[model samples]
Target: MKKNQSKISIKDIAQELGLSITTISFIINKKAKNRISDEVIQKVEAYIEKVGYKPNSAAQSLRTGKTKTIVFMVEDISDPFFSSVAKEMEKLAFDSGYKIIFCSTDNKKSRAIELISMFKDRQVDAYIITPPEDFQDEIEQLVSENQIVMLFDRFYRDADYNYVVLNNYGSTKRAVEYLKNQGFKNIAYVGLKTELSTLTDRFDGYKEAVREANRENLSLLISFDDVKSEVGNKQFEEFLELHPEIDAILFATNNLAITGLKILKKKNIQIPEDIGVITFDDRDLFELHAPAITVMSQPITSLAKEVISGTLKLLKRKHSIQDKIQIVLDGELIVRKSS
Candidate 1:
């Protein structure tokens, strides 16, 4: 019979090196510290290297009770902000010997719950979530089970968990203030109507800015379900027609900004001439536009590093982290002609 050229197992290495399977496992897992002699360790290590033996991750996971996998759940994997951060995080996690599984929740509670359950079944070592609305209960359950979880972008107020997020309120407030200072009155805020803290914080910032400036607050909060549809575009068009005096608009997200820009283009409203625009998240599309869009750019790399480090600390049990760790990074205001 033709031999199967499957991966070389720990057992094969152990037998060839005249050592016990336990010895090989201990060394491979880096658990033999001071327990095994250097001579035997060196001998086994050399032989394993010579034979090109790679440990079976499935078996190792079963023995160690760690899958070395991280589940990254975001509102939308295709969103530039999430995708950029995920890419950086994936590289960092891979360097630390962990794999990341990316999933999009589409801001749907049911989809988030389903993804969480699926990852749990596969025994992921940790979860990094940009949670949807009303996900506190599910997250609290994960935390109760000692499952490592790191919330990103948005978080539930009632849930205590590790998170790395931007200063949403401050960033939006600053962007609005910049517009107000530039003589843009009748500024309108465009955002999704969602209970997620991230959007709410941004909305609060816009309201606060308008109030502080002694200007009337104008906003269009589209339904989360309809934000991407023709209904949303029509809503924007109606909003503009309802308030022809709106000189500037701040969109709470990149996608919202994109939609608003498209509406403006259709209406032949020139940017910064008839309407000034500023968006919460930065994107290449914004930069490539005729008049580049000013944006509140999140520190994606910093966020990714903090998240990866926090997750690794939890997985390695390196230190006793607080019950809940909250790391809020600042967003940079990238000035452009649009604003």
Candidate 2:
């Protein structure tokens, strides 16, 4: 209670409680390997409060060689699909005694690389990435160094790593099949243009549906790599103008689907009545819109669990486990007025 007291330290708390600073450190950080008595721990903690002692996370991390943190790098954090996945992953990581930080690249390759370098220097415990462009080389290097890097929602062409993704091919095929059954003669597909395995798989499903329909009479319009609102909306508008008779559009992701809605609204196009809409992932805005939008929602919780468990398994391995699991969870189609 002095007028100008200096900053408190572990030494001060230890001196006041008649214990060594090492004991106080172990008890406070819950690293009491020898099972320090409850009474001693309580006394140290109480004295810590009395002296206003605080532990420095940097120092603790240096001593333990563990940040106890995981990082998730995604194309766009604002995108409904990534946002949902981030929330679930954070919750699961926290429950398992780890923290998670989300890094959004906006689908930029350079940005993703910068974050990868930064996280590496910071010694993050693990990473889950939806990489940009040809970052598989970078990811492979990390994996070779025994870093825990799990691919989520996407897969690399020549790299072997853990991944949790939805069954993109089957889901999109089902969506297109549904539209065809509803008498939609002109079906279009909209999504980002990337070598990303997920988008490619979904695009394959769209192609399969077209080929299986055996309808040379039906029209198919495919749009790709529409990331931003302005770009996406403009492209969608141009497509609609060029093909005025398109009956249904299948979006590869929720962000593209949202942009499609904006363009359709501006053009005064009626849903299902004029142009049917079905998006890949669901969000709150989709449910609250004028006519609730339908979605093919991924199993976010299951995906998170799978990735986290896989990372833990990797961390426990003597060498990289050759059990490369490409888990393909299902996406549910939520039908609404738009479809």
lDDT per prediction? Answer: 0.89, 0.80
Candidate 2: global Cα-lDDT? 0.80
Candidate closest to the true structure, highest TM-score: 1
Expressed as tens digits, the lDDT of each residue in 1-339 for candidate 1 is 322325677777778788898898889889888989989888888776676666778888899888889999998899889999999999999999999999999888999999888888999999999889888888889888888888988877665678888999999899999999999989999998988999999999999989999999999999987777999999999999999999999999888888899999999999999999999888898999999999999999999999999888777772455555789988999999998
Per residue, candidate 2 scores C-alpha lDDT tens digits across 1-339 of 332224666787778788888898898788875678888888877766666666776877898877888889998887767887788878888887889889898667799988988998999988888888778888888888878888988887566678888899999999998888888888888766667788889888888898899743232223445455466566667777878778888988776777778878888998879988888888889899878887888888888888888777766672644787668888888888887
Each model's RMSD to truth, in Å?
A: 2.3, 3.4
Model 1 C-alpha lDDT versus the unseen true structure: 0.89
Candidate 2: stretches off by over 4 Å: 1-6, 34-52, 216-235, 241-245, 312-322
Model 2, TM vs. native: 0.84
Assess every candidate by TM-score: 0.95, 0.84
Clashing pairs in 2: 192-225, 193-225
Q: Which segments of candidate 1 are over 4 A away from where they belong?
A: 1-7, 318-323
